[model samples]
Each structure stands twice: as C-alpha cells, then as structure tokens.
Target: MSTFDTDLLIVGGGPGGLATALHARRLGLSVIVAEPREGPIDKACGEGLMPGGLAELTSLGVDPAGMPFHGIAYLDERRRAEARFRGGPGRGVRRTTLHAAMAARAKEQDTEWIRTRVNTVEQDAHGVTAAGVRAKWLVGADGLHSSVRRAVGIDVTAGTPRRYGVRRHFKVPAWSEFVEVYWSRWGEAYVTPVEPDLVGVAILSRGQPDLAWFPRLSRQLAGGERGPARGCGPLRQVVSRRVAGRVLLVGDAAGYEDALTGEGISLAVKQAGAAVTAIVEGAPESYEAAWHRVTRNYRLLTRGLVLASTPRPARRAIVPAGRLLPSAFRFGVNILAS
Candidate 1:
C-alpha cells in the first residue's frame, strides 16, 4: 500500500465524498479520496434529483450531458400532478452513471484515490488518520454508522430501526413527468427516469425488507407494462442518527429515511458542499448546523413516508390522506426537495 499525505482526506467516494474531493480540488486544497470500492458501486435508490441539489452541481460546474438521464415526473395512487417540475432540469440518472461522472471529475482534478477498505480511523487536533493516510482535515463521507464519526468520539441518537427499501431498474416510458412516487398503505414505489429507456424503481417500507410486493410495485410504474419477472430485496435500515465532531458525516452517513422520498442521493450531494464549505473556512459547526436545518425538512417528509409504509392499519392510514391532500403532503416534500 502507498502512504499518502494531503491537506484533506476523504474516506468514501460515494456522492458525498466525491463531491468533497471535487470542490476541495477547485479551491486548490491538497486532497485524497480513499474509497474502498472501485468505479461505481450499485446502490438501492430511486436516483431522483431535486432542484436545489441539481443547482449545486451547476455551481460546481459539472455538465450533466456527460451523464444523461430522464427529466422529472410525479404520481400517486389518488390524484396526479398535471405539470412537470416547475423547477429547472433534474435528472433521474442511474447510480452508476452519477458515480462514474463524479469519479471522472474527481480524477480530472487529480484527487488521489485509493481503492481499499478503511480498517479504521484515528483522530486528533491536527487531523484524522484513515487506514494509513493522514491529513489536516478529515471527512466521513462513509455512510450511516460512520466509522469516522465513532472514531472522532461523536455519537448519534437513532430512532428504533424500522422501514426497509429495495431499488432496481428497468426500461420504461415516462408515464408522468416528475419522478412518480406512488403512495400506498403497505409501502411506496418510486419510479424515476434514469435514462431515455431506463427507470429506477424502489419500494420502501418501515422496519423490514419486503419481498412479496415486488410484483405490485412493478405493475404500478409500468402503467400496466410488464416489469422484471424476478424480484428485489427489501433493503432495510434505521430512521435517523446524528454524528457530531470536527470530522462530520454527510448523506446517509448522517441519517437515513424512507427511500420512497427519493432524496437520499441528492441530500448527500447537498451536504457534501456544506461540509466542505464548513471545513475550508474554519468553522466546522456551520456544517453541522446547516445540515440539521436542511436535513430536518427531508426527515419530516420521510417520516410521513415511513409511517405510511407501516403494516399497522392505524399508522398506514396516512397514505390516502397524503394522496388526497397533496398540498399538505407536498408542503413537506417541497421544503425538503428545494
């Protein structure tokens, strides 16, 4: 293994970590990204981009043409959105496409990347150490339950783990214009436009990974078209957590919610900018403070989604109410998505 030194070290090359490397390089900071995985790692996600997050990409100067994707669309069990996203362009690119583009950008910036799993991280006043790489600043772009967060002596409170999600992709037409999030009593399936012929699909429920409903989820997104014959897993995880320290956690590393909201990847991208800004200037608190404000709205909307996916009739009742009163539902969503 090669021992490296830099001004900043990022441990994870997912969206959050990659964005960190990209921005830090632009600012002329000496940086290295140590991602255990090579290329784009597949993830269970709806892959929808919101306006605020997309704007950040433009601000960073990344051209989406390099990674083509569908525009936007929205749908529900009850009423349907008559208009496409009033906001500017947002893509439903595949996770691999987004990752590949980011990887390409980071490499172009000469952000030293190491493809190896981090054994652990140790931190002090000067900076943090991951695997063997050390730097002046440390960022945990890792994920929920971040090893960096724990190593930095930060502990996060987590709601009892509930809700699970499974995401897969297939060729489909844009039945609607925005990423269609189909609300249901059991769970919600989000259909996203990733490419001209491909759509990313996900079904998330609270507490457990599901299997039985894959067929139903496929049917909804297809507008009656036949979906993949096999099935997808119920990718399951907890609701939320907060890691506080100089080494901050962003994206799912910060917290997780129901995937049906289609905000995870975009949220990570947004937090990456905020976290880098916080570290570059000198006040790390700003990143944490800012993240709470931004992440809170998404959490609120996601919590409703979590409740709607629950098996209990009482808890699941929120589904129809949300579908019927999109204003109330959309209010939280708009706050989060923007």
Candidate 2:
C-alpha cells in the first residue's frame, strides 16, 4: 500500500495553486489539486504581469498571450509621468487567459485534479489529508479567504486600512504601450490593455466602487462595451504563520498587503517555488523565512505608498513627485517589477 496518496496535495486551483502543481511536478513529486470551480477562474485584478513575472511564468513553460506594455505611467489632472522597464516588457493578460494557460501547463506536467471544494484540512507530523486526499504535504494556494489557512490556525486579522477593488473590461483599441494608473481624490484606477481591442479597468479605494468618482477616467471609458464587473477586497491580509506541520500556505493564502504595486501574481509564483523546494528538501519550516524574504519589499513599499496616498495633499503630490524625481520613480518601479 502507498504510504500516502500523493507527494503533494494542493488546495484551490487559482493561478497560484496551479503554479504550485507545476513546480511540484518539476521536482518529481506526484501532485493532486482540488478546486471547486470549473473552467478558467477569473478575478478582479489589474491583470498586468510585470516583466519579471512574465519571465518567471515563461520559464515554467506557461506563457499566456496578451498585449505588451513597456512600463508604467502615472497620470493625474495636474501631471503625467512614465517609466519604461530597463529590460523587457510586461504583458497585460486577462485573468481567465492566464488561468487557462497555467491549468494547461499543470495538466501537461501530469498533475491530477479533483473538482471539489476543500472544506476541511487535517494534518499530522508526517503528512496532510485535505479534501479527502492524503499526501506528504498540503499547499494552500487559495485566495484571500482561504479555508485551509483558517483551518490550520495561521490566518491573521488585517491591521491595515480596508480597501476594495472592482474591475471591468472595455472594448477599445490600444492607445499606449504602458500600464496607465490614473489618480483621483477617491482612489486609483489601473488601465491595462489585455487584447488589441480590450482594455481592463480596475479601481481601488475604501469607498464603494463608483466610476463617477473618477470623472476623467469615467469620461475616457464612457460608452464602451462594458463586460461584467468583478470585485475583491479588503486587500490586506495578515497571517500568524505560513507552515503548520506538513501543510504550507502559498500565494494570497499565506498573506497579502495590497494590490497597489501589482506584484501579487509574481510573488505568488515565486512563493510557490519556495514552498515546493522546502517540501522536496524535507524542511517545510524553512518556507516561512523564504516567504518573508520574498515579500519584504512588497510589504514595505506597498504599505508606504498606500499610507502616502491616503492624505489628499500627499495624494495630489504623488504624480508631481514622480515627475520631478524621475530617477527615484524609475527605481521604485524597477524594484517592484523585479
């Protein structure tokens, strides 16, 4: 009889979960993934993969087709500042497309799948059994409200300001080669071109999503074929720990600060690799330190920016500050992109 059903059992089938499956397969581990949803998963996201993130996904042999953007553009009524990445370009891929590509890659790697929700998680010193599968290890790649995180007693209460994000797609021709962020008194709007004739707009704020809050961006997106809007929120998530016995938390399930810097996918993929490495080496505890190292910059910089953006005077100065200090802005963008 097999000691365990598989080497790794992954909960949730989002991009992060699928990425974990691919990495585990690459390390010669038998894997099974459980996801409640069918078909490609979609979420309310900015959908722009930074250059480094695109490269990471490609290295894993999971590249999705989308529009290309050179860098980032910060725009406001008073000023506009743009910065191109030093090396390659970021791609504005739709969430569904990205998820499909990741799932296909996981399937190609011979990963098993279970189309069911993981309502309970049980683990001991040797292995974990979740969603009815017993494995040497369990990875929670679930989203912000991960059941596994809660079940394992690692979930933490978010201490930062609560904010939400709502996104919609518009049918419009590509006008620029940059991911543009338009600022207003209310919140920030991210415009990314996912297809030649499709642009995704996501607004982040504390208040309810009302495009009317941003007059300029609303006017720009006026009268277009609007796709169904999706919302996700209270962007910040804290965690007491990442590893509990044989179970490890990855991606948003591990913890999250905010989406302001757009590093979620990249960080998730990177954390997936680290989580699998620790599992393969028989040192699940090491993943906690690795997670901190990987997310240090994201946590600090994103928190600082979010704080700076809260005050009206400071928010108004954001664009002009970037414009006046191009080098500093470029450095910031490069750090986040990297």
Candidate 3:
C-alpha cells in the first residue's frame, strides 16, 4: 500500500471537523477533510442557533440571507412563557441547508474533501496515521463514540443516558421569533421555525424518553395540529475525555452532554476554532488549556440542568422555581452559562 500525505487530516466531516478545516484553510494551512459521504447535510440536532453561533458564521464568511430557516422561537410549555428571536434576527434553517452552507464554504476555501471511512489510526511522537496516511495533526470531530477517540485509547466515562429524543417536520404557520422550550414535569420540547411556514419540533427527556409526551407539544406548535413523527435512539449522556498525544479531539468526540441547552453545535464550532488556534499558536499545551477554559462552565451548567430534570422530591422544586421565578431563574441561568 502507498502512504498518503497531508499537513492536517481530519477523520470526520461533521460540523466540528468541517468548521476546523474551513478555518485552517483560510489561515493558509494545507487541509484535507475525509468525509464518507459526498453530500452536505446537517447532523441530528434540535436546530437552534444563538447569537454567538451566528457570530461564528460571520467570521467564517457565510451569509444566511439565502439559506432556508430564519428566526428563533421559544415556548415555556409548562410555565406558559415564551420568546421569539424574530424581534432581532437569528435563524431557523433545516439541518440540510446549514450543512450545505458549511460544505460549500469549506470547498470554496480550497479544502480537499475525501470520501473514505478510516480503518484505524496509528500515532506516535510525530503525528497520526490512518489507512496508510500520515498527517501532522489529527482531529477527532467524529461523534460521541468517535473512531479516533477509541483508536487513541481514550475512553469516556459516561453518565446515565437520558430520555429518548424524537423530532419531525410540519408545514405550519409562522410561529414566534424565539426557540420555544416547553417546560413540563415530563421533560422539555423545542419548536424551531425553519422557514416561512415550516418548523421542526424536538422532544428531549432526562430519564427515559417518552415519544408520546412530545407529540402534543409538537401539535400545539403546528397550529394546534400534529405533524409527522420522527425519533432517534436513547439520548446520550455526559461524555468527557481528553487524551493528549499527537492527536486531539473536539465536538461530541471530546465530550457530549445533554442537548437541552441547544448549544452543542455552537459549542462544537467554537471549540473547533479554539482547537485550531491553540494548535497553531501554542501547540498541544495551549490547546489543552483552551479546551478546559472553554468547556468548564458549560459542563457545570449542563449537569445542573440535568438535575432540574431529575425526578425527585427535592429536585422537583425546579418546576416551581422555573414557573414562579422566570426572570430570576433566567438571570441565574444566563450568569452560569456565561
């Protein structure tokens, strides 16, 4: 077999990996992205973008004007409180559109896209090796159970898997301007507007996901009408791991916590930027320190949210607190997350 060469070889083509490649290419770095699939598409997500995420898009030179999905809508199902992002400006595009944009942008920057699944990764003091290929640096942007993470002997100590997540699309009238989070003792469901009259509803659970619980919420958002049902396997738990050598991991590959905050993609993209900056400026040590600084508060906040969802007498107080103290609660949440 012949060996392949590259300055940086990314094994996963998801947002984290793709974002890294895009930024690195802009920085005049030789980059190659190995994505098994040729088409660009969004991964499984609730589909909400915050201001910070939009800022990243701007830094990447992407324009949201043409994409499908605009605005944000939030609903407090239990508390009956809601907000809309349409007031200012956000986005509510389908996963595919977002993915296509990222893929196109990466290509525009001259990133060499590869269609191949990695067989294995062998590394040493120099760099990482995969399929007889060698790269100066390897990134594990793959998902929760990343192939790169496994190949590096980096095992994730997981918390119990929470609820089963289900989602579906509906051709409904325009909803609010914020990503709505319906809070109930059962769990939290999010309704996001992707187009002029299209929305995606995602139901997430803490203990065991109950598909039936979210359908009503979905119906309520779709103009008091139900839409097609969509579902995914049991929700993932809090996964945190960092095995430092020649290779590094980011996105869900590094750690995957509850998706309740709708911060996964944004956090992943931001972390990818951080990882690249660290690698270029400070090498491995800087990258490690930056990663810790980035995810430190996020981990604590997510764990606290999980507790709020936990069904116990003492923890049950979250329901009342969230209901009676909306402003106060949001203030604390904002502080903790920031």
Please give each candidate's TM-score: 0.82, 0.98, 0.85
List candidate 1 stretches off by more than 4 Å: 1-4, 65-84, 156-158, 207-217, 220-245, 308-326
- Pairs with steric clashes in candidate 2: none
Judged by lDDT, which candidate is best?
2
Model 3 lDDT per residue over 1-338, tens place: 42448777887887888888877887777888877887865555777665566668768976553222233223333434322233234556676777788888888888887788875888777777875568778887887767888787776765664555666766776556566766655777777777776777777765554535555464655444555565653445344455467677888888766777676777777788887876676376677667778877667776677775676553445546655766755554443323
How large is the C-alpha RMSD of every model relative to the true structure?
A: 4.3, 1.1, 3.7
Best-fitting candidate, scored by TM-score = 2
Task: List model 2 lDDT by residue over 14-67, tens digit each.
Answer: 988988998889889999999989999999999999988888899899989999
Q: Ten-residue segment with the worst summed lDDT in candidate 1? A: 230-239
Error of 1 at 301 (Å): 2.8
Candidate 1 lands at a TM-score of: 0.82
- Global local distance difference test of model 2: 0.90
**Residue range 220-275, candidate 1, lDDT tens digits:** 45543434422323333342333344477777667665465566777887788777
Model 2 — TM-score against the truth? 0.98
